[model samples]
Target: MPIDNNYTVKRIPPSDVDLYKELRLEGLKDTPEAFGASYRDESTNARSYYYTLLENHDVFGVYRNTDTLVGIAALALSPKEKLKHKGTLWGMYIKPEARGNELAKQLVLQIIKIAKETTEEILLTVVASNVSAITLYKKLGFIEYGTEPRALKIEDRYYDEVLMRLPLT
Candidate 1:
C-alpha cells in the first residue's frame, strides 16, 4: 500500500529523545540482525548519548497522526577531513504496525534528499538475508559494492552485510 497521506516525516530533534529512544530500542530488540548496535549495549547508554546522536546527525522520524513517532532513520555525515564528503545511513526502522505502507521508502528518500546536500555519496550496510531492504535500496538507486562476512556477531551467531552505496555526485 502507498504511504498514508496523514503520516508526516521530519527531522527528529534532541527534545524528542524519549520518543526516539523508545523507537530505537524497539527496533534493536525486534530485529537484532538488521542493526549494527545491540539493545544490550544501547540500553545501558546514558540519555546524553542519545542526545548527542540527535544533536550530531540528521535523524528523521515518521509520525502517525502527526504526534506518534512510528519510524526513524539517520544520516550521519563523516566529520573527518578525509571523509567529509561521505555520509552513512543507519538506524532505519519502522514499527511493525507501520510497515507495508511504504513509510520506510518515504523515510529513506527524505534521508537521501538531505544527504545529497552535503555528501558526495551515501553508504549503507544491510544484512544479506534482508531481501526486502536490499530490494528497496536498489530501487532507490543504491548499488551493491561488496559483502562483509561476519559483519555482526551475536551470541555465537554471525550475520553478513551487503555494502551498498549511492553516489550523489
Candidate 2:
C-alpha cells in the first residue's frame, strides 16, 4: 500500500529485530494501558524472542523520511481451523510527534488490506478510555460488539476494553 511521501509503511522483517524491539518498548512505555503486554514482561525477553515474533507475526512499521521508525501495528492470525478465518490486530502505536498525521490510519489500512487476503474479519480491543483510538477504529469500519471489563489491571487500577471487529467479507 502507498503512504504519504513523508512517511513509509512496511513490514518489520526478522533482520530488523533491534529496531522492532526498540519501537515495541517505546510503545509499551508510552501507553501502558493500550497494549496487552507489560513493559516489564517484554523488557526481560531475549533478542531471539523478538526475532521470533517478527518471523511469526505480520508486524508493520511506519518510518519517517529520515528512516526513523515512528509507528507500528501487528496482525496475528490463529492457526486453529475454527478460527482461521479471523485475525487480531494488536500492538498499534505511533510516536507522540507523529500523532497529528494520518500515519495510524495508513498503518491500519495496510493491515486490513493484508488481512483481507486470508481472513474474513479482524478483531481488536482498545482501552475504553482511549476515545481517539476508538474513533479511528470506527472510522475504519470497525464496530464495537461488546465490552470486556477489567481486561487489564496495572498496579491497583483496572481498565476496561471495548471489543470491536471489522468484517472483511
Candidate 3:
C-alpha cells in the first residue's frame, strides 16, 4: 500500500467521521501509553469524545484510491488562553501498509497551510521514541522546545515525550 509520490490529499468530511474515529481508536489502542488519553478513557464523554475531532479539529487525509482511508491527521486549536495563538498537531497515523510513502509529509504540509491561517505557531507532541514523526515535524519547521520526562505511564513503565513547535511567522 505504499503510495506513489503523487496521491490525493483532501480535507476530511463529516461523512468520514466513522472511519476517522476508527483510525483514531486504532492509534490509541496500538499505543495506549504513548498518548495522553486512550480510546477507552474518552469513549464515555459524549461532548469531549469525538465531537470536536469530528466537528472542530482540522483534518487531512491521504487516500489509496479516491475513497479509501489510509492515513489521517488532526490539527486542533489550543484551548488555553495564552496558547490560543497556537494549534496542536496530533492523532497522526497511517495504516501499516501505508508507512513508507510520503503521505505523512503530505498531511503535515497541508496542515501547515491551515495553521498559517490562524497563528504564528504550531505545537506537536511526540513520543521520544518516534523519530520519524519528530524528524518530519522538524523538516516542516518545528523545533524541539523541551522534553516531558516520563509524561505518561503504563503499568510499571514510563515513556518520555518531546514537545515541538513551529513558529509560523
Candidate 4:
C-alpha cells in the first residue's frame, strides 16, 4: 500500500540528531551486509560526527504522525568539482515495523527528487543478494552499471554490491 497522509517526508533538521543516530545504528546492526559502515565504528563517534553528517548531506526522513521518524535516506553530492555533477544515494533504511508500507520507495523517491536539482546522475549501491532492493531500484528506473565483488566484509564473510545509476540529465 502507498503511504498515507499520516506519513510525512521532510529533510531532517540538525536538532533531530538523536533520532537519526538511533535509527542509523539500528539499521547498521540489523543488516551489517547492507552497509559499508560498521556499527562498532559509528557508535563510538561523538555527537558532532552525526552533526557533520547532517550538515554535509541531504538527509531526508519519513515520519509517522509528525513525531516518529521511521525511515531515512540521504543524498551526498560530491564536493570535488569534477564529481560535483554526480550525487550518491546512501544510508537508506526503514524500521522493521514500518516495512511493507512502501516507506523505502518513498524515501528513495524523495532522494531522487532532490538529487535532480543538483546532479546529472544519482548513483547507489546495494548488496547484490538483496533482491527486493534491486527490484525496487529497477522499477524506479535505476540501471545496473556493474557489480563489485566482495564490496563489504563483515567478520569472515563478504557481500558483493550491485552498482546502479539513474541519469537525471
The best candidate in terms of lDDT: 2
| RMSD, one per candidate, in order | 2.0, 1.0, 3.0, 1.8
lDDT of 4 by residue, 127-151 (tens): 9999999999999999999999999
Say which candidate scores most in TM-score: 2
Model 2, 124-164: lDDT tens per residue?
Answer: 99999999999999999999999999999999999999999
Please give the lDDT score at residue 145 for candidate 1.
Answer: 99
3 or 4, greater by TM-score: 4
Q: Looking at model 4, which ten-residue stretch has the lowest summed lDDT?
A: 1-10
Using lDDT as the yardstick, the better of models 1 and 3 is: 1
Q: How far is candidate 1 from the true structure (C-alpha RMSD, Å)?
A: 2.0
The better candidate by lDDT, 2 or 4, is 2
Instruction: Give each model's clash number.
Output: 0, 0, 1, 0
Task: Please identify which of the two predictions, 1 or 4, would achieve the higher TM-score against the true structure.
Answer: 4
Prediction 4 TM-score vs. true: 0.96
Model 3 pairs in collision: 120-168
lDDT of each: 0.93, 0.93, 0.78, 0.91
- In model 4, which runs have C-alpha deviations exceeding 4 angstroms? 1-3
Q: Candidate 4: which pairs clash?
A: none
Distance (Å) between predicted and true CA of 111, model 2? 0.4
By TM-score rank, best first, the candidates go 2, 4, 1, 3
lDDT for predicted candidate 1 compared with the true structure: 0.93
Clashing pairs in 2: none
